[model samples]
Target chain A: MMVACAVLPAAARSAAGPTNPFLRLPMVTIATHRLVLRPFRRSDAKEFTRLAGDWSVASMTSDIPHPLSEGQARGWLKPGRREVRFAIELEGRLIGGAGYYQRRSGTAELGFWLGREWWGRGYATEATRAVVHYGIEVKRLPGFTSSHFVDNNASAGVLRKLGFEPTGRGRIICTARGYEVEAVTYWLPARYAVQAQPVMARAASAGRWRAWLSRLAGRPA
Target chain B: MIDAIRTDRLVLRPVHPDDAEAIRAQIADWDVMRWLSQPPWPYTLQDAVDFIGSCSPDDLTTTAFAITHAGAVIGVIDMRINPALLPLRGPGPHLGFWLGRAHWGNGYTTEAARGLLASAFAAGVGDTVYSGAFADNAASLRVQEKLGFVRNTETLVFARPRGREFPHVNTKLVKSAFRTA
Candidate 1:
């Protein structure tokens, strides 16, 4: 995707002020080599339903309802007025989502979920790294709070890989079960978030470099 | 929209502009506002209006109410999901409330909070609700204790009004324990 940005008209590329190298870059849609994290769109409803509606997916989450009704996916895709949410896409296909929700008190929490087939590929971690980057590096949050069902070892692995530490235990509603479930809470400090997956950082920087070169060479891209 | 909840001694109703005056009067006093984490120290009528403006019960993230006794606003009670954390997917709204200084020590805070918890749990909002109180605020802590909130952790939380961090005890109430409590 970064290399693709090299083909844009040079005149348009240079329109961005060059006084600051970073300022010259375009708004990030959160891309890693294997995934693109962007804002959720209404058109993604069908795909979201197909993936997120699965019983396997819904049961693990504390909030997502099993048997997601028709059109409900679109409703979930609606932008939160004050929250940051994103759709995780692979080769332009929607696969999952990740983002933070800021409370009225000005604190925020990190949450994410992915389609079942996409599991075990490290997509959760890579996508999380991108969003966490946006949270700390872009949104400038100090850190985020997260949790997982004590029995959901897969989710625990994802949180652990992202550098989150167990803070304590608590009971939370599991919407899928319509009952409370035991869960372990975790808090990831800003310093750990700053160290999110290096591969994502390298991929993003490489894209910026290509864009920068295109602008410098006065090429159409 | 917020449905009015009637406790034995208080009415918990959705706040509106007309109630702003009473809200300001109650919260403007430092004695009542000292333990609050947000809303500036010197609160004003406009702050009350803005708060009511954002108090829609239909919002999935928050539910705000005016705690009334004998048809007069005495304080506010609310629950909100911490916006920063993304849940695996469930309602985990945190509990918060405050009463006019004069209304304290009468168990009104405890009564109002218990009623709110009952409503939230019945509606399938979550299996548990979380709350916290400044370590020094024995009154607030007592209310939690009376409602059967178990201490989960002790952490330093920022007090926006005072511009400093203070010791606080985080608490959680499990739904199953509601019957026993």
Candidate 2:
């Protein structure tokens, strides 16, 4: 459906901006069956430092350093204009972190790190899927890119479940490891959710519904 | 800003945790799930709870309502900032809705849209509203037609439930053209 802006006379319209409307929005707390992926809050700083500080967890991520410091953890949580970061929580307890950082090329890069103790339970996959879906369904991002050190087999399995396809191999420094390591890059188009079909099912039809809502005992939605 | 709407046959209200079971019952149906762009297939109670939890009075980006008849939720409707429109223009409300298959053909959908659209326009957020349905969802398209929504664009929409794209027709309604009744 046409938007209100189009109804205005040319002289009244704002300076033409980029036409594509799909861009990062204010970070929103995304929820899935097993997780609550939310913007990091100050109260979480201590737990974040502890989990990300673990040697097993820090070693897997590219930027997080060993002995993750309160100062460094605070730096990661700083509100950013170009990226959306979420602190992954399970049952009100902090576990890992997942979110995307946008590139000037107009695509977001998805990244995540889970506590060593929380590994093997599929929380990484579950948390990352929420981020990906939020990128596609809510943010309208065109695609996402991610990489894992080739040696991190557990991480590779998680990416596979999210349908991230191999793009190439490259070297990225693992700060926790104190050196560069071989990594495999992967890409997943936002379109993957709406892949090739005879017709675009349910895409772009946000107006396919009508109805007003009444308060449900002061509930949301 | 709109918190509640009352149509002759329906009370469009905020979704409640109590509505969780009913929302799951209808949305899990392939008949409804197939038409929605979001909401994964094999719908779970957790998904329903998540959706309800996501709704908030303060969130200007999305406003959702449960379409209730006789105090029972039979459907859901929402208007939210169309992310695609946020750049070129501003936050334009995108309207969408779905009902249990059993509730179809009762004119309830149209009634709900009228109440919500009128309230939205009255809020002075925007003068026009955008909406559309899957090409094959003629019933949904017809509902838009009744509200004075004219076809504006056509494109493929990715749906999570089907895990594949399907053709969709997008439409829009201006305040002046809406059918208030």
Candidate 3:
């Protein structure tokens, strides 16, 4: 596992070079207190398809139609896109996904989901905090917008715990639901983005040191 | 082979096609690329191949070398014309370099950059060498200052690895002010 990629925003997408635009960045790994947020690997397609494919996982978000196929999962995991995605891994098992989507020149929207089995463990909060921290500290994204389907109180609580203030309510297309669903929207300004206790600093040192040691010992990195 | 420059602690030599994997492993890092002004994110093997293919020992405009220690490619250093900055900054080759994340904090960047700068200047690469780091990249700025690169201005520059245009501290070193040691 080469394990290198970036949380690239829009402008940097094409600056990769003249030789090829088939841009695949090394995965940029994000570690939390108990979880690891990493780039989605090609090998993750099967697990991701099976997990994100569940109606329990897909119906809440604006995208990700239910019954997601392996091919669709593979396509979603492909690099070279404008947004940055991270596979939320807990104890080396893929639990769900989180990332910055709709990345514009300055800000991006936040999104995530977990398999039903993985929900309510505060895993979503921990993973999302790390992602938000990366956005604020690393990407310098000033603001982010997110929403939860009206009935999904779990997501609503997750957003509220993260300091997102409800901006409005509207019927948004839920590709998974196959219709317009009433969604309550919220926004997180930079000020509110600061409280996320990101474990990135410590994780970088521990992870980098471990990775360096492993490489020195000729282990797979 | 012919243009490899030897320093007290390192070897600065032409980037080779065979160095693709090492180059990829090191430069693909966010820790490395976050400060760079150009180049793609996620630096793939093909980009490494293309970069090595574009390098020329004799061409100052595209002078690039692999920094080696113990005969292992540990990093890369290059000086190339920045077409984007050429109009605004004027007549200078932009210098850029990076070491493997594991190799950092060892003063290898200072050592390797010193070696490359000495060679580039001796070959009459240019009268002026332009360099800078992201506003937040203090370590890199420190290296240039140690090399006698005087600070010039600050500008917002777009760097892909950072995923947005960021504040860049621009510096320039003239042939007269160049510190080779």
Candidates 1 and 2, the one with greater DockQ: 2
Model 2 preserves the real interface contacts to a fraction of 0.02
DockQ of 2: 0.04
Q: What docking class should model 3 receive?
A: incorrect
Off by over 4 Å in 1: A1-221, B59-61, B85-91, B179-181
For residues B10-58, write the lDDT of model 2, one tens digit per residue: 8988787888899999889998988887798799999999999888755
Off by over 4 Å in 3: A1-221
lDDT of 1 by residue, B77-173 (tens): 9887754321211237888899998888898888889888888887788788888787678888888888888776543344656543334566778
Candidate 1, residues A109-158, lDDT tens digits: the string is 67788888888889888777667655554444556777777777787888
Cα error of candidate 2 at position B39, Å: 9.9
Provide the lowest-lDDT 10-residue window in model 3 chain A.
A15-24
CAPRI grade, predicted model 2: incorrect
Candidate 1 lDDT at A172 equals 76
Best by lDDT: 3
lDDT of 1 at A1: 5
Model 3 C-alpha lDDT per residue in residues A1-221, reported as the tens digit of each score: 00001123355442111211111223255545466666788899999888878887777766676789888889877654557788877767888888766454455677888888898889887777667766654554556777777878888778788888899987877777788888787888755665433332343234433443465599965
Candidate 2 chain A worst ten-residue window by lDDT? A1-10
